[model samples]
Target: MTEIKFYRVNDAYGYLSNFAPYPFEINGLIWSTSEHYFQAQKFLDKAIQEKIRRLKSPMDAALEGRNRENPLRSDWEVVKDDIMRLAVFEKFCQNPAIRRELLATGHATLIEHTKNDNYWADNGDGTGKNMLGIILMETRKRLKAE
Candidate 1:
Protein backbone atom coordinates (compact mmCIF):
# COMPACT_ATOMS: atom_id res chain seq x y z
CA MET A 1 0.00 0.00 0.00
CA THR A 2 1.13 3.56 -0.62
CA GLU A 3 1.87 5.74 2.37
CA ILE A 4 1.03 9.39 2.77
CA LYS A 5 3.55 11.90 4.04
CA PHE A 6 4.03 15.64 4.35
CA TYR A 7 7.37 17.24 5.27
CA ARG A 8 7.52 21.04 5.49
CA VAL A 9 4.88 23.19 7.13
CA ASN A 10 4.43 24.96 3.80
CA ASP A 11 4.20 21.60 2.15
CA ALA A 12 1.40 20.74 4.53
CA TYR A 13 -0.21 24.09 3.87
CA GLY A 14 0.06 23.58 0.15
CA TYR A 15 -1.43 20.13 0.39
CA LEU A 16 -4.30 21.53 2.38
CA SER A 17 -4.88 24.57 0.22
CA ASN A 18 -3.61 23.42 -3.17
CA PHE A 19 -3.26 19.69 -3.84
CA ALA A 20 -3.05 16.29 -2.27
CA PRO A 21 -2.84 12.68 -3.47
CA TYR A 22 -4.77 11.10 -0.61
CA PRO A 23 -8.05 11.33 1.27
CA PHE A 24 -8.56 11.57 4.99
CA GLU A 25 -11.61 10.27 6.77
CA ILE A 26 -12.45 12.55 9.70
CA ASN A 27 -15.65 13.15 11.66
CA GLY A 28 -17.25 10.39 9.57
CA LEU A 29 -16.73 12.34 6.36
CA ILE A 30 -14.01 11.88 3.76
CA TRP A 31 -12.00 14.97 2.99
CA SER A 32 -9.88 15.44 -0.10
CA THR A 33 -8.18 18.72 0.65
CA SER A 34 -7.08 19.96 4.02
CA GLU A 35 -8.79 23.23 3.21
CA HIS A 36 -12.16 21.53 2.89
CA TYR A 37 -11.57 19.22 5.80
CA PHE A 38 -10.31 21.86 8.18
CA GLN A 39 -12.96 24.30 7.23
CA ALA A 40 -15.60 21.71 7.86
CA GLN A 41 -14.16 19.99 10.91
CA LYS A 42 -12.33 22.86 12.60
CA PHE A 43 -12.95 26.28 11.13
CA LEU A 44 -16.72 26.03 10.97
CA ASP A 45 -16.84 25.85 14.71
CA LYS A 46 -17.90 29.34 15.74
CA ALA A 47 -15.26 29.72 18.41
CA ILE A 48 -12.47 28.55 16.14
CA GLN A 49 -13.54 30.76 13.25
CA GLU A 50 -13.69 33.77 15.54
CA LYS A 51 -10.17 33.10 16.71
CA ILE A 52 -8.83 32.50 13.20
CA ARG A 53 -10.51 35.64 11.85
CA ARG A 54 -8.45 37.66 14.28
CA LEU A 55 -5.38 36.87 12.23
CA LYS A 56 -4.60 38.94 9.15
CA SER A 57 -4.23 35.85 7.02
CA PRO A 58 -4.98 32.37 8.30
CA MET A 59 -2.27 30.82 6.12
CA ASP A 60 0.39 33.30 7.20
CA ALA A 61 -0.70 32.82 10.77
CA ALA A 62 -0.25 29.05 10.51
CA LEU A 63 3.25 29.50 9.13
CA GLU A 64 4.14 32.03 11.77
CA GLY A 65 2.44 30.14 14.57
CA ARG A 66 4.88 27.26 14.02
CA ASN A 67 7.73 29.38 15.34
CA ARG A 68 8.10 31.29 18.60
CA GLU A 69 9.78 34.15 16.76
CA ASN A 70 6.56 35.33 15.15
CA PRO A 71 6.00 39.00 15.78
CA LEU A 72 2.33 38.17 15.95
CA ARG A 73 2.82 35.53 18.60
CA SER A 74 0.41 37.32 20.89
CA ASP A 75 -2.41 36.89 18.40
CA TRP A 76 -1.34 33.44 17.30
CA GLU A 77 -1.08 32.18 20.83
CA VAL A 78 -4.83 32.46 21.17
CA VAL A 79 -5.51 30.31 18.11
CA LYS A 80 -2.42 28.12 18.17
CA ASP A 81 -4.38 24.91 18.46
CA ASP A 82 -6.53 25.68 15.47
CA ILE A 83 -3.49 26.62 13.40
CA MET A 84 -1.74 23.43 14.30
CA ARG A 85 -4.84 21.40 13.48
CA LEU A 86 -4.88 22.92 10.03
CA ALA A 87 -1.24 22.07 9.62
CA VAL A 88 -1.68 18.50 10.80
CA PHE A 89 -4.82 17.76 8.81
CA GLU A 90 -2.65 17.47 5.71
CA LYS A 91 -1.51 14.10 6.87
CA PHE A 92 -5.00 12.86 7.65
CA CYS A 93 -6.44 13.83 4.28
CA GLN A 94 -4.82 10.91 2.46
CA ASN A 95 -7.19 8.34 0.99
CA PRO A 96 -8.61 7.33 -2.39
CA ALA A 97 -11.82 9.18 -1.60
CA ILE A 98 -9.90 12.42 -1.39
CA ARG A 99 -8.30 11.84 -4.78
CA ARG A 100 -11.73 11.31 -6.28
CA GLU A 101 -13.06 14.43 -4.59
CA LEU A 102 -10.09 16.43 -5.82
CA LEU A 103 -10.96 15.40 -9.35
CA ALA A 104 -14.64 16.16 -8.85
CA THR A 105 -13.88 19.59 -7.47
CA GLY A 106 -11.77 20.34 -10.55
CA HIS A 107 -8.93 21.41 -8.27
CA ALA A 108 -6.79 18.32 -8.34
CA THR A 109 -3.64 19.85 -9.75
CA LEU A 110 -1.10 17.40 -8.44
CA ILE A 111 0.98 18.00 -11.51
CA GLU A 112 4.75 18.66 -11.70
CA HIS A 113 4.96 22.38 -10.90
CA THR A 114 1.96 22.31 -8.59
CA LYS A 115 3.28 19.52 -6.39
CA ASN A 116 4.50 20.75 -2.98
CA ASP A 117 8.11 19.57 -3.26
CA ASN A 118 9.87 21.40 -0.46
CA TYR A 119 9.52 18.38 1.78
CA TRP A 120 7.56 15.96 -0.39
CA ALA A 121 10.88 14.53 -1.58
CA ASP A 122 14.42 15.86 -1.55
CA ASN A 123 15.35 19.49 -1.80
CA GLY A 124 17.24 20.41 -4.92
CA ASP A 125 20.35 20.95 -2.78
CA GLY A 126 19.77 17.58 -1.04
CA THR A 127 19.05 19.10 2.37
CA GLY A 128 15.59 19.03 3.87
CA LYS A 129 13.73 17.94 6.96
CA ASN A 130 10.23 16.53 6.54
CA MET A 131 9.19 17.41 10.07
CA LEU A 132 5.44 17.17 9.55
CA GLY A 133 5.76 13.98 7.51
CA ILE A 134 7.88 12.39 10.21
CA ILE A 135 5.38 13.27 12.92
CA LEU A 136 2.48 11.85 10.92
CA MET A 137 4.34 8.61 10.24
CA GLU A 138 4.96 8.01 13.92
CA THR A 139 1.43 8.97 14.82
CA ARG A 140 0.02 6.54 12.30
CA LYS A 141 2.20 3.77 13.68
CA ARG A 142 1.00 4.37 17.23
CA LEU A 143 -2.65 4.51 16.22
CA LYS A 144 -2.45 1.29 14.26
CA ALA A 145 -0.98 -0.55 17.23
CA GLU A 146 -3.88 0.34 19.50
Candidate 2:
Protein backbone atom coordinates (compact mmCIF):
# COMPACT_ATOMS: atom_id res chain seq x y z
CA MET A 1 0.00 0.00 0.00
CA THR A 2 1.20 3.51 -0.74
CA GLU A 3 1.92 5.65 2.31
CA ILE A 4 1.96 9.42 2.55
CA LYS A 5 3.99 10.66 5.50
CA PHE A 6 3.24 14.14 6.85
CA TYR A 7 4.32 16.27 9.81
CA ARG A 8 5.63 19.80 9.37
CA VAL A 9 3.02 22.29 8.27
CA ASN A 10 5.37 23.55 5.56
CA ASP A 11 5.85 20.13 3.94
CA ALA A 12 4.08 18.97 0.79
CA TYR A 13 1.35 17.10 2.70
CA GLY A 14 1.31 19.78 5.38
CA TYR A 15 -2.36 20.48 5.00
CA LEU A 16 -2.97 17.14 6.62
CA SER A 17 -1.30 18.34 9.78
CA ASN A 18 -3.52 19.74 12.50
CA PHE A 19 -1.10 22.61 12.95
CA ALA A 20 -1.67 23.84 9.44
CA PRO A 21 -3.26 27.30 9.35
CA TYR A 22 -6.72 26.08 8.49
CA PRO A 23 -9.22 28.13 10.39
CA PHE A 24 -12.45 26.28 11.04
CA GLU A 25 -15.59 27.17 12.91
CA ILE A 26 -17.11 24.83 15.47
CA ASN A 27 -19.34 25.37 18.46
CA GLY A 28 -19.99 28.89 17.20
CA LEU A 29 -16.33 29.86 17.46
CA ILE A 30 -13.58 30.00 14.88
CA TRP A 31 -10.47 27.98 15.58
CA SER A 32 -7.14 28.98 14.10
CA THR A 33 -6.23 25.39 13.44
CA SER A 34 -7.44 21.87 14.14
CA GLU A 35 -4.75 21.54 16.79
CA HIS A 36 -6.22 24.46 18.68
CA TYR A 37 -9.67 22.98 18.49
CA PHE A 38 -8.50 19.55 19.57
CA GLN A 39 -6.43 20.86 22.47
CA ALA A 40 -9.05 23.31 23.68
CA GLN A 41 -11.63 20.56 23.87
CA LYS A 42 -9.56 18.90 26.56
CA PHE A 43 -10.94 21.38 29.05
CA LEU A 44 -14.51 22.16 29.99
CA ASP A 45 -13.72 25.60 31.28
CA LYS A 46 -14.84 28.22 28.84
CA ALA A 47 -12.02 30.46 29.98
CA ILE A 48 -9.42 27.85 29.20
CA GLN A 49 -10.99 27.16 25.87
CA GLU A 50 -10.99 30.84 25.03
CA LYS A 51 -7.43 31.13 26.18
CA ILE A 52 -6.37 28.35 23.87
CA ARG A 53 -8.37 29.82 21.04
CA ARG A 54 -6.65 33.18 21.34
CA LEU A 55 -3.14 31.79 21.44
CA LYS A 56 -0.89 33.00 18.62
CA SER A 57 -0.07 29.53 17.43
CA PRO A 58 -1.21 25.92 17.56
CA MET A 59 2.02 24.92 19.31
CA ASP A 60 1.16 27.30 22.11
CA ALA A 61 -2.34 25.92 22.32
CA ALA A 62 -0.91 22.42 22.51
CA LEU A 63 1.46 23.44 25.26
CA GLU A 64 -1.35 25.01 27.29
CA GLY A 65 -3.53 21.96 26.81
CA ARG A 66 -0.79 19.73 28.22
CA ASN A 67 -0.41 21.80 31.34
CA ARG A 68 -1.79 19.65 34.14
CA GLU A 69 -2.44 22.75 36.23
CA ASN A 70 -5.68 23.21 34.40
CA PRO A 71 -7.50 20.00 35.13
CA LEU A 72 -8.61 18.03 32.10
CA ARG A 73 -12.24 17.11 31.67
CA SER A 74 -13.06 13.90 33.50
CA ASP A 75 -14.08 12.20 30.28
CA TRP A 76 -11.21 13.54 28.18
CA GLU A 77 -9.65 10.13 27.57
CA VAL A 78 -12.92 8.62 26.40
CA VAL A 79 -13.85 11.56 24.20
CA LYS A 80 -10.50 12.71 22.81
CA ASP A 81 -10.50 10.61 19.64
CA ASP A 82 -13.99 11.66 18.74
CA ILE A 83 -13.05 15.25 19.46
CA MET A 84 -10.04 14.95 17.19
CA ARG A 85 -12.16 13.44 14.46
CA LEU A 86 -14.64 16.29 14.69
CA ALA A 87 -11.92 18.91 14.59
CA VAL A 88 -10.19 17.36 11.59
CA PHE A 89 -13.42 16.83 9.71
CA GLU A 90 -14.57 20.39 10.29
CA LYS A 91 -11.17 21.67 9.23
CA PHE A 92 -11.37 20.12 5.79
CA CYS A 93 -15.05 20.83 5.34
CA GLN A 94 -14.74 24.53 6.13
CA ASN A 95 -11.64 24.93 3.94
CA PRO A 96 -12.41 24.07 0.32
CA ALA A 97 -8.83 24.18 -0.89
CA ILE A 98 -7.57 21.64 1.63
CA ARG A 99 -10.71 19.58 1.22
CA ARG A 100 -9.81 19.19 -2.45
CA GLU A 101 -6.26 18.49 -1.43
CA LEU A 102 -7.39 15.76 0.92
CA LEU A 103 -9.70 14.26 -1.69
CA ALA A 104 -6.83 14.26 -4.18
CA THR A 105 -4.93 11.71 -2.12
CA GLY A 106 -7.21 8.96 -3.43
CA HIS A 107 -6.67 5.86 -1.28
CA ALA A 108 -3.09 6.26 -0.28
CA THR A 109 -2.50 5.55 3.42
CA LEU A 110 -1.95 8.75 5.40
CA ILE A 111 0.73 8.65 8.03
CA GLU A 112 1.48 11.29 10.67
CA HIS A 113 5.23 10.97 10.63
CA THR A 114 6.59 12.14 13.98
CA LYS A 115 8.54 10.68 16.86
CA ASN A 116 7.15 13.11 19.43
CA ASP A 117 3.72 11.58 19.59
CA ASN A 118 3.36 7.84 19.45
CA TYR A 119 -0.40 7.60 19.62
CA TRP A 120 -1.12 10.23 16.98
CA ALA A 121 1.94 9.61 14.80
CA ASP A 122 3.94 6.67 13.40
CA ASN A 123 6.58 7.07 16.15
CA GLY A 124 9.19 7.31 13.42
CA ASP A 125 9.33 3.49 13.48
CA GLY A 126 5.91 2.28 12.27
CA THR A 127 5.01 1.08 15.79
CA GLY A 128 2.66 3.80 17.02
CA LYS A 129 -1.08 3.68 16.47
CA ASN A 130 -1.10 6.78 14.22
CA MET A 131 -4.60 7.67 15.29
CA LEU A 132 -4.41 11.06 13.55
CA GLY A 133 -3.70 9.35 10.24
CA ILE A 134 -6.54 6.95 10.82
CA ILE A 135 -8.86 9.83 11.60
CA LEU A 136 -7.73 11.65 8.46
CA MET A 137 -8.43 8.58 6.32
CA GLU A 138 -11.82 8.22 7.89
CA THR A 139 -12.49 11.89 7.22
CA ARG A 140 -11.39 11.45 3.61
CA LYS A 141 -13.82 8.59 3.15
CA ARG A 142 -16.60 10.63 4.63
CA LEU A 143 -15.72 13.61 2.44
CA LYS A 144 -15.61 11.48 -0.71
CA ALA A 145 -19.05 10.09 0.03
CA GLU A 146 -20.41 13.59 0.46
Candidate 3:
Protein backbone atom coordinates (compact mmCIF):
# COMPACT_ATOMS: atom_id res chain seq x y z
CA MET A 1 0.00 0.00 0.00
CA THR A 2 2.78 2.38 0.84
CA GLU A 3 4.53 1.72 -2.45
CA ILE A 4 1.37 2.24 -4.47
CA LYS A 5 0.50 5.44 -2.71
CA PHE A 6 4.07 6.64 -3.15
CA TYR A 7 3.97 6.03 -6.92
CA ARG A 8 0.78 8.02 -7.42
CA VAL A 9 2.10 10.93 -5.43
CA ASN A 10 5.45 10.73 -7.20
CA ASP A 11 3.94 10.70 -10.66
CA ALA A 12 1.81 13.75 -9.94
CA TYR A 13 4.71 15.69 -8.53
CA GLY A 14 6.92 14.68 -11.41
CA TYR A 15 4.38 15.79 -13.98
CA LEU A 16 3.53 19.08 -12.37
CA SER A 17 5.67 22.20 -12.43
CA ASN A 18 6.55 24.20 -9.29
CA PHE A 19 6.17 20.96 -7.47
CA ALA A 20 8.31 20.22 -4.40
CA PRO A 21 8.57 17.65 -1.69
CA TYR A 22 6.18 19.75 0.35
CA PRO A 23 4.14 22.91 0.74
CA PHE A 24 3.53 24.99 3.86
CA GLU A 25 0.69 24.87 6.35
CA ILE A 26 -0.22 26.27 9.73
CA ASN A 27 -1.93 24.44 12.50
CA GLY A 28 -2.17 24.24 16.27
CA LEU A 29 0.39 26.42 18.07
CA ILE A 30 1.23 27.90 14.65
CA TRP A 31 2.89 24.63 13.54
CA SER A 32 1.83 21.49 11.77
CA THR A 33 2.40 18.85 9.11
CA SER A 34 1.71 19.30 5.41
CA GLU A 35 0.65 16.94 2.66
CA HIS A 36 3.19 18.36 0.20
CA TYR A 37 6.23 17.48 2.31
CA PHE A 38 4.97 13.97 2.92
CA GLN A 39 4.29 13.34 -0.76
CA ALA A 40 7.53 14.96 -2.01
CA GLN A 41 9.83 12.90 0.21
CA LYS A 42 8.07 9.69 -0.74
CA PHE A 43 8.99 10.14 -4.42
CA LEU A 44 12.43 11.62 -3.74
CA ASP A 45 13.32 8.39 -1.96
CA LYS A 46 12.04 6.26 -4.82
CA ALA A 47 13.93 8.28 -7.46
CA ILE A 48 17.21 7.78 -5.60
CA GLN A 49 16.53 4.10 -5.01
CA GLU A 50 15.52 3.50 -8.62
CA LYS A 51 18.67 5.21 -9.87
CA ILE A 52 20.72 2.81 -7.80
CA ARG A 53 18.80 -0.11 -9.18
CA ARG A 54 19.30 1.06 -12.76
CA LEU A 55 23.03 1.44 -12.26
CA LYS A 56 23.31 -2.31 -11.82
CA SER A 57 22.14 -2.86 -15.39
CA PRO A 58 24.44 -2.10 -18.32
CA MET A 59 21.48 -1.43 -20.65
CA ASP A 60 20.09 1.26 -18.43
CA ALA A 61 20.86 4.04 -20.93
CA ALA A 62 18.73 2.48 -23.64
CA LEU A 63 15.96 2.02 -21.10
CA GLU A 64 16.39 5.50 -19.69
CA GLY A 65 15.48 7.29 -22.92
CA ARG A 66 12.24 5.38 -23.23
CA ASN A 67 11.44 5.87 -19.57
CA ARG A 68 11.89 9.63 -19.76
CA GLU A 69 9.55 10.01 -22.72
CA ASN A 70 6.73 8.15 -20.99
CA PRO A 71 4.24 10.32 -19.13
CA LEU A 72 4.04 7.75 -16.36
CA ARG A 73 7.49 8.87 -15.24
CA SER A 74 8.36 11.90 -13.05
CA ASP A 75 12.05 11.31 -12.50
CA TRP A 76 13.05 13.06 -15.70
CA GLU A 77 10.55 15.82 -15.21
CA VAL A 78 11.86 16.71 -11.78
CA VAL A 79 15.43 16.76 -13.03
CA LYS A 80 14.42 18.77 -16.07
CA ASP A 81 12.59 21.41 -14.09
CA ASP A 82 15.49 21.91 -11.72
CA ILE A 83 17.92 22.21 -14.58
CA MET A 84 15.62 24.54 -16.52
CA ARG A 85 14.96 26.80 -13.56
CA LEU A 86 18.65 27.12 -12.86
CA ALA A 87 19.36 27.75 -16.51
CA VAL A 88 16.82 30.54 -16.70
CA PHE A 89 18.09 32.17 -13.54
CA GLU A 90 21.65 31.89 -14.78
CA LYS A 91 20.68 33.69 -17.96
CA PHE A 92 18.69 36.22 -16.01
CA CYS A 93 21.62 36.90 -13.72
CA GLN A 94 23.58 37.96 -16.74
CA ASN A 95 21.02 40.68 -17.44
CA PRO A 96 21.58 43.91 -15.52
CA ALA A 97 17.97 45.00 -15.63
CA ILE A 98 16.63 41.77 -14.21
CA ARG A 99 19.21 41.72 -11.45
CA ARG A 100 18.51 45.33 -10.56
CA GLU A 101 14.79 44.73 -10.61
CA LEU A 102 15.15 41.71 -8.36
CA LEU A 103 17.27 43.55 -5.83
CA ALA A 104 15.17 46.68 -5.85
CA THR A 105 12.01 44.70 -5.23
CA GLY A 106 13.50 43.32 -2.04
CA HIS A 107 12.23 39.87 -2.77
CA ALA A 108 14.17 37.74 -0.32
CA THR A 109 14.55 35.20 -3.11
CA LEU A 110 16.31 37.89 -5.11
CA ILE A 111 19.59 36.32 -4.07
CA GLU A 112 19.02 32.59 -3.75
CA HIS A 113 16.28 32.11 -6.29
CA THR A 114 18.06 34.23 -8.84
CA LYS A 115 21.29 32.34 -8.41
CA ASN A 116 22.48 29.73 -10.84
CA ASP A 117 23.45 27.42 -8.02
CA ASN A 118 22.40 26.47 -4.48
CA TYR A 119 18.83 26.12 -5.67
CA TRP A 120 18.51 22.41 -4.99
CA ALA A 121 20.90 21.67 -2.18
CA ASP A 122 19.25 19.45 0.40
CA ASN A 123 20.60 18.20 3.69
CA GLY A 124 19.56 16.05 6.59
CA ASP A 125 20.27 18.82 9.04
CA GLY A 126 18.32 18.84 12.29
CA THR A 127 17.50 22.53 12.05
CA GLY A 128 13.94 23.00 10.79
CA LYS A 129 13.46 26.63 11.77
CA ASN A 130 11.80 27.58 8.47
CA MET A 131 9.76 26.22 5.62
CA LEU A 132 10.99 26.19 2.02
CA GLY A 133 8.40 28.49 0.43
CA ILE A 134 8.36 31.01 3.22
CA ILE A 135 10.66 33.53 1.60
CA LEU A 136 8.69 34.15 -1.60
CA MET A 137 5.40 34.23 0.21
CA GLU A 138 6.84 36.63 2.70
CA THR A 139 8.09 38.77 -0.15
CA ARG A 140 4.59 38.93 -1.53
CA LYS A 141 3.29 39.89 1.88
CA ARG A 142 5.78 42.71 2.19
CA LEU A 143 4.89 44.00 -1.23
CA LYS A 144 1.22 44.06 -0.39
CA ALA A 145 1.91 45.80 2.90
CA GLU A 146 3.84 48.53 1.16
Candidate 4:
Protein backbone atom coordinates (compact mmCIF):
# COMPACT_ATOMS: atom_id res chain seq x y z
CA MET A 1 0.00 0.00 0.00
CA THR A 2 1.14 3.52 -0.75
CA GLU A 3 1.85 5.64 2.32
CA ILE A 4 1.42 9.40 2.24
CA LYS A 5 3.32 11.42 4.85
CA PHE A 6 2.79 15.11 5.37
CA TYR A 7 3.92 17.85 7.75
CA ARG A 8 4.92 21.14 6.06
CA VAL A 9 2.11 22.98 4.30
CA ASN A 10 4.07 22.96 1.06
CA ASP A 11 4.32 19.20 0.87
CA ALA A 12 2.15 17.27 -1.58
CA TYR A 13 -0.18 15.88 1.12
CA GLY A 14 0.14 19.06 3.17
CA TYR A 15 -3.56 19.74 2.81
CA LEU A 16 -4.11 16.76 5.07
CA SER A 17 -2.20 18.46 7.86
CA ASN A 18 -4.09 20.29 10.56
CA PHE A 19 -1.78 23.25 10.00
CA ALA A 20 -2.94 23.59 6.43
CA PRO A 21 -4.67 26.88 5.63
CA TYR A 22 -8.14 25.43 5.28
CA PRO A 23 -10.55 27.62 7.14
CA PHE A 24 -13.60 25.91 8.64
CA GLU A 25 -16.66 27.02 10.51
CA ILE A 26 -17.71 25.24 13.69
CA ASN A 27 -19.54 26.24 16.85
CA GLY A 28 -20.86 29.15 14.78
CA LEU A 29 -17.36 30.60 14.25
CA ILE A 30 -14.76 30.46 11.52
CA TRP A 31 -11.41 28.89 12.35
CA SER A 32 -8.23 29.63 10.38
CA THR A 33 -7.12 26.04 10.46
CA SER A 34 -7.75 22.75 12.24
CA GLU A 35 -4.67 23.50 14.33
CA HIS A 36 -6.26 26.71 15.58
CA TYR A 37 -9.53 25.02 16.38
CA PHE A 38 -7.83 22.09 18.08
CA GLN A 39 -5.60 24.29 20.21
CA ALA A 40 -8.30 26.81 21.04
CA GLN A 41 -10.45 23.96 22.29
CA LYS A 42 -7.98 23.31 25.10
CA PHE A 43 -9.37 26.32 26.92
CA LEU A 44 -12.83 26.97 28.21
CA ASP A 45 -12.44 30.75 28.30
CA LYS A 46 -14.22 32.55 25.50
CA ALA A 47 -11.54 35.24 25.43
CA ILE A 48 -8.78 32.73 24.96
CA GLN A 49 -10.73 30.92 22.29
CA GLU A 50 -11.33 34.16 20.44
CA LYS A 51 -7.70 35.12 20.82
CA ILE A 52 -6.49 31.88 19.29
CA ARG A 53 -9.07 32.08 16.52
CA ARG A 54 -7.89 35.53 15.54
CA LEU A 55 -4.22 34.66 15.61
CA LYS A 56 -2.45 35.20 12.28
CA SER A 57 -0.95 31.76 12.01
CA PRO A 58 -1.63 28.21 13.15
CA MET A 59 1.84 28.09 14.71
CA ASP A 60 1.00 31.17 16.75
CA ALA A 61 -2.26 29.60 17.83
CA ALA A 62 -0.41 26.43 18.86
CA LEU A 63 2.13 28.35 20.91
CA GLU A 64 -0.58 30.36 22.60
CA GLY A 65 -2.57 27.23 23.37
CA ARG A 66 0.55 25.71 24.99
CA ASN A 67 0.86 28.60 27.43
CA ARG A 68 -0.13 26.86 30.67
CA GLU A 69 -1.05 30.21 32.19
CA ASN A 70 -4.51 29.59 30.78
CA PRO A 71 -6.18 26.66 32.39
CA LEU A 72 -7.14 23.84 30.05
CA ARG A 73 -10.58 22.37 30.27
CA SER A 74 -10.72 19.41 32.65
CA ASP A 75 -11.94 17.05 29.96
CA TRP A 76 -9.26 17.96 27.42
CA GLU A 77 -7.47 14.64 27.49
CA VAL A 78 -10.63 12.57 27.21
CA VAL A 79 -12.41 14.64 24.58
CA LYS A 80 -9.44 15.79 22.51
CA ASP A 81 -9.71 13.03 19.92
CA ASP A 82 -13.35 13.73 19.29
CA ILE A 83 -12.58 17.43 19.02
CA MET A 84 -9.89 16.71 16.43
CA ARG A 85 -12.19 14.40 14.50
CA LEU A 86 -14.83 17.09 14.30
CA ALA A 87 -12.28 19.71 13.26
CA VAL A 88 -10.82 17.59 10.46
CA PHE A 89 -14.21 16.42 9.25
CA GLU A 90 -15.57 19.93 9.11
CA LYS A 91 -12.45 21.19 7.37
CA PHE A 92 -12.87 18.75 4.48
CA CYS A 93 -16.61 19.14 4.38
CA GLN A 94 -16.40 22.91 4.09
CA ASN A 95 -13.57 22.97 1.56
CA PRO A 96 -14.64 21.32 -1.69
CA ALA A 97 -11.27 21.39 -3.38
CA ILE A 98 -9.54 19.76 -0.49
CA ARG A 99 -12.40 17.36 0.04
CA ARG A 100 -11.83 16.08 -3.44
CA GLU A 101 -8.13 16.02 -2.85
CA LEU A 102 -8.61 13.94 0.26
CA LEU A 103 -10.92 11.50 -1.47
CA ALA A 104 -8.53 11.22 -4.37
CA THR A 105 -6.04 9.46 -2.18
CA GLY A 106 -8.24 6.34 -2.23
CA HIS A 107 -7.05 3.69 0.25
CA ALA A 108 -3.53 4.95 0.78
CA THR A 109 -2.30 5.30 4.32
CA LEU A 110 -2.03 8.85 5.58
CA ILE A 111 0.73 9.67 8.03
CA GLU A 112 1.52 12.90 9.78
CA HIS A 113 5.29 12.52 9.80
CA THR A 114 6.87 14.78 12.43
CA LYS A 115 9.31 14.37 15.27
CA ASN A 116 7.97 17.29 17.24
CA ASP A 117 4.69 15.57 18.03
CA ASN A 118 4.56 11.96 19.13
CA TYR A 119 0.86 11.79 19.73
CA TRP A 120 -0.59 13.52 16.70
CA ALA A 121 2.21 12.62 14.32
CA ASP A 122 4.41 9.60 13.67
CA ASN A 123 7.40 11.01 15.62
CA GLY A 124 9.19 10.95 12.26
CA ASP A 125 9.93 7.26 12.91
CA GLY A 126 6.52 5.49 13.15
CA THR A 127 6.64 5.19 16.93
CA GLY A 128 4.06 7.87 17.76
CA LYS A 129 0.32 7.33 17.73
CA ASN A 130 -0.27 9.37 14.55
CA MET A 131 -3.72 10.26 15.70
CA LEU A 132 -4.03 13.10 13.24
CA GLY A 133 -3.47 10.80 10.30
CA ILE A 134 -5.89 8.33 11.77
CA ILE A 135 -8.49 11.08 12.15
CA LEU A 136 -7.93 12.19 8.58
CA MET A 137 -8.53 8.69 7.31
CA GLU A 138 -11.65 8.41 9.39
CA THR A 139 -12.82 11.75 8.09
CA ARG A 140 -12.22 10.55 4.56
CA LYS A 141 -14.32 7.50 5.21
CA ARG A 142 -17.14 9.57 6.64
CA LEU A 143 -16.95 11.96 3.74
CA LYS A 144 -17.07 9.09 1.31
CA ALA A 145 -20.13 7.67 2.99
CA GLU A 146 -21.99 10.95 2.86
RMSD (Å) per prediction: 9.7, 0.6, 17.6, 0.7
Using lDDT, give the best candidate's number: 2
Candidate 4 segments whose C-alpha is farther than 4 A from its true place? none
Backbone collisions counted per model: 5, 0, 3, 0
lDDT of 4 at 140: 89
* Over 4 Å off, model 2: none
Model 1 residue runs over 4 Å out of place are 1-18, 21-30, 35-122
Give candidate 3's TM-score: 0.24
Q: Of 1 and 2, which scores higher on lDDT?
A: 2
Instruction: Compose the digit string of candidate 1's lDDT tens values, residues 62-116.
Output: 4433433323324543563454354344444354443333333332222212234
Clashes of 4: 0
lDDT of 1: 0.39
Model 2 worst lDDT run, 10 consecutive residues: 19-28
**Angstrom error at residue 136, model 1:** 2.8
lDDT of each: 0.39, 0.96, 0.30, 0.94
Instruction: Tell me model 2's lDDT, rounded to 2 decimals.
Output: 0.96
Give the better candidate number (1 or 4) by TM-score. 4
Identify the runs in model 3 with alpha carbons over 4 angstroms from their true place: 1-74, 108-146
Error of model 3, residue 2, in angstroms: 40
Give RMSD (Å) of candidate 2 vs. truth: 0.6
Candidate 2 lDDT by residue in tens digits, 1-146: 88999999999899999999999998799999999999999999999999999999999999999999998999998999999999999999999999999999999999999888899999999999999999999999999999
Instruction: List model 3 lDDT by residue over 1-146, tens digit each.
Output: 11100112245222111221222222211101122222222233556324423342323422443353333435654554443333233322334443354345443421122122233211223122222223323433443464
| Cα-based lDDT at residue 144, candidate 2 | 98
How well does model 3 score by local distance difference test?
0.30
